[model samples]
Target: MRTGGGSMTTPVHNSPRTLVLSTKTWERELAAELVRLGHSPAKSRYVANKLLKRIVGRAGWQRQAFLVD
Candidate 1:
C-alpha cells in the first residue's frame, strides 16, 4: 500500500458492506430516482454500482454517487 509516496496502492475493500445494496426491489426505479435528482448511478451491474471501479483501474473520485443535494 502506498503512503507518503510509494508504488503500491492501498487495498480498497478493507471492510464488508461498506457500501450496501439498495432496498428498492426495482433497479430501474432507483436509477430513475438518481437521474431525476441530477446524479448518476456509478454503474448498473449490482444493486448499487456506486462502489465499482474497473479492475486495475483507479477507484472513482466521487464518494457520494447516490447522494442528492
Candidate 2:
C-alpha cells in the first residue's frame, strides 16, 4: 500500500493475524499514542521515527521477529 514516505508490500502469506502497516502510518500512530500517554510531541515523534527506521523495508513477519529479538 502507498504510504506517506513510500509503499509497503504485504507478503504473500497474508493471514488474519498478519497486520502490515506502512512506516509512516506506524510512526504517526505510535507518536500519537505516546503523546496520549503524556510524552512530549517532540519526544514522541523522535521515539517513533527511531523505532520505525529499523523496520523501514521489512515485511510483517520479519519486522515482528526482529522486534521480538
- What C-alpha lDDT does candidate 1 achieve relative to the native structure? 0.36
RMSD to the true structure for each prediction, in A, is 14.2, 6.9
Q: Give all TM-scores, in the order shown.
A: 0.25, 0.49
Question: Model 1 off-target regions past 4 Å?
Answer: 1-25, 41-69
Write model 1 residue lDDT over 1-69, tens digit each, in one string: 112232222333654323322223224454556666766456442423332333212554433222211
In model 1, which residue pairs have backbone atoms overlapping below 3 Å? none
- List candidate 2 segments past 4 Å from native: 1-14, 54-69
- Report the CA-based lDDT of candidate 2 relative to the real structure: 0.59
**What is the C-alpha lDDT profile of model 2 across 1-69, one tens digit per residue?**
223443543433545435456555667778988999999997899898777765554543433322210
Give the whole-model CA lDDT for all candidates, comma-separated: 0.36, 0.59
Among the numbered candidates, top lDDT falls to 2
lDDT of 2 at 42: 78
